[model samples]
Target: MRATTTPALFTRPRNVAASVAAAALALTLVPGSASAQQADTEPVDVRLKVADAAPVEVATTPQAWPGELLEAYGVSVDGNDLVDVVRDGDEVSGERKRLRQGDVVRLTDVVKERKTKRERVRRGTVEVFTTELKPGVRKVVREGRPGTRVVVARKTFHNGEPVKYRVIKRKLVKDPRPRRVLVGREAYAVAGANGLNWGALANCESGGNPDAVNPAGYYGLYQFDLGTWRSVGGSGLPTSASAGEQTYRAKLLYKQRGRSPWPTCGRLL
Candidate 1:
């Protein structure tokens, strides 16, 4: 016998049958499968069939601020709304009033009027009266009587006759005349230094009566009230004695106090 070498071969029976079935199926289905794959892989012109949706509606409203704002400055308002007051009441255009919390709503104009001063009137009065006098006649009197051989009395008159004559003279003449006068002569005099106009002051004070005295005991051309006179260095001089002096003193005071002396002096200063 010749020496023979043989190669050993091993095969799984289940795998072999599967492989044969796979080969048969591949041979039979490969063309159809390839065409199906090609159809799936190829890009197609796709179109989405989406229906038109109704337009979504959004609710919208205007926003408003809570309260009105006032823009006016330094003006008082009298109405509920500041703008109305400034526009209508004040008649100011482009200047509407701005209102704020705790604000007082009243408007007014501050006006100062010139002061009116009444002239001081120096008061004075005059009095006159008549009285009957007896027991005296024209430098002669009857002594004894006509029955006792009668001493001749000069200028002939009967004895024991009632005479309608009386001594007519003033016993006491007080400030016997009412004169229009100023109340503050000294004050006026002092005012003279301050360019006080005496022309008008005298017209109002005493009408230029140096002897004028008021019912209130004010005396002199300036008609110084008793209290005022005493205060202004008045020496209680009779109105006649101290008119000039009082005026001088008053002018000095005017210079000191810067007050309108003419008012006190009835414009005399």
Candidate 2:
């Protein structure tokens, strides 16, 4: 014998709500199968009461489901289906939503869904940078390697579709080391111990003017002082000396001190 339940809950299909209607065939509520009954202690109890008509008998049972929930919708459940539940209701491309064995026909109190994404920021960490030292190198200095900033974006979704989006916020993710450049600044060789290239030395001293004389009594292409010129075996003013004599004396000075005598300017030589 089929059992009857009242005050059932109705469910609308995912897409349509008002499309349900009376069927051409009589929908008879049948008793559940033994398996359905075993799955539920209550058994698959389903019974239908039609207005001005006697209750009818159908076959099979609802698969591990509650059939009483269909009552309030005026749907007569014969097993898992209702009579006249066909595929000719809502039109799309000249076709209606087709009904299959396990289709949900109706729904109530359902909420529509839309997808969206939001962005957020998180704090970043600072890092250290080191420069290697090489031979003839003096000391390594550290100035602190402050990091830089980066921009990022995030997207959210609703109902498997994008609805709303924005550049919600900024985030810091990396701390870079301070700016560092490897440099060389020290000279280990004895000043001027290496022979000087005098041609370059003359250009720096006086633009190679053999008659060049400074206001301070320094005279000649080599900018020789009076005493220094005589010490180098040159008599009289160096400007009065021949270019050959002046060059000879300059060579002597280079041999003695390498180039310490012309420190800053000798580097070109």
Compare the candidates by lDDT and give the number of the best one.
2
List runs of model 2 lying over 4 Å from the truth: 1-196
Query: What C-alpha RMSD separates each model from the true structure?
Result: 49.1, 20.6
Give the per-residue lDDT of model 1 (tens digit) for 43-135: 211111001112111111111001111010111222321222222334332323333222222222122222222232333332221122222
Best prediction by TM-score: 2
Distance from true position, residue 172, model 2, in Å? 91
Instruction: Compute the lDDT of residue 181 as modeled in candidate 2.
Output: 40
- What tens-digit string does per-residue lDDT give for candidate 2 at 20-108? 22211212322332333443333233332222123332222344232333432334443322222222343222123232333333311
